[model samples]
Target: MLELGENPDTAYQKIKQLFVHLNLPERLWSLSPTTFSGGEKQRVNIARALSVDYPILLLDEPTSALDETNSKAVIQLLQERQAKGSALIGIFHDEHVKNQLCTRELTFGD
Candidate 1:
């Protein structure tokens, strides 16, 4: 298992492309950590995680930084991964994401 924090290097790209099958490569160096928008950074984070090619993934609030379109794309990506027999544990607050991605729900606190 791989734990990718923020600001991974560009060398992870090749592995990311192979497992996540993404056409877009993140331009991490183009923007400083402070200058990066939430969405862009989230994309980078996902790319870094995908680089490891793990069979199981746990994402905490994966799409929290994304806009609607990117959020949908991320959800679709997770579904595709699941179909490939990869287990994805996604934690989200967005009802849309939860409804679309999850077959069961577990809520903490009331």
Candidate 2:
């Protein structure tokens, strides 16, 4: 963001959308993550990662711990990122989700 002349603080405000999409209660914002539940922490992890504009992202089972609704939300956010030309490399054990998000597949031991 600095290279693009974008203020990191202002750009980081995107986290609001992330938290909303990931179903994190706004109250989680003021509290320490150590006190959060596993699911909440996982949602935070997803939100934190998506808050930045990295050229390449490496993900491993991003939605593995989420419910169907949350998983769909994550997929929608990822699709939007992909549409904006972000490169996503991930391990998706869920074939349904894999089909939804992946355009090209790199398989091993096939």
Best by TM-score: 2
**On a 0 to 100 scale, what is the lDDT of residue 89 in model 1?**
76
The per-candidate count of clashes, in order, stands at 0, 0
Q: After superposition, how far is residue 48 of candidate 2 from its true place, in Å?
A: 1.3
Report the alpha-carbon TM-score of model 1 versus the true structure: 0.68
C-alpha local distance difference test of each model:
0.68, 0.85
Q: What tens-digit string does per-residue lDDT give for candidate 1 at 1-110?
A: 22455345544556455324433344545557577667766766776666555799898988887777777777777787778788877787888888887877788988
TM-score of each: 0.68, 0.85
The prediction achieving the highest lDDT against the true structure is 2
lDDT value, candidate 2, whole model: 0.85
* Per-residue lDDT of candidate 2, residues 65-110 (tens digit): 8889998998898888899999999998899899998889988876
Collision pairs in model 1: none
lDDT of 2 at 13: 73
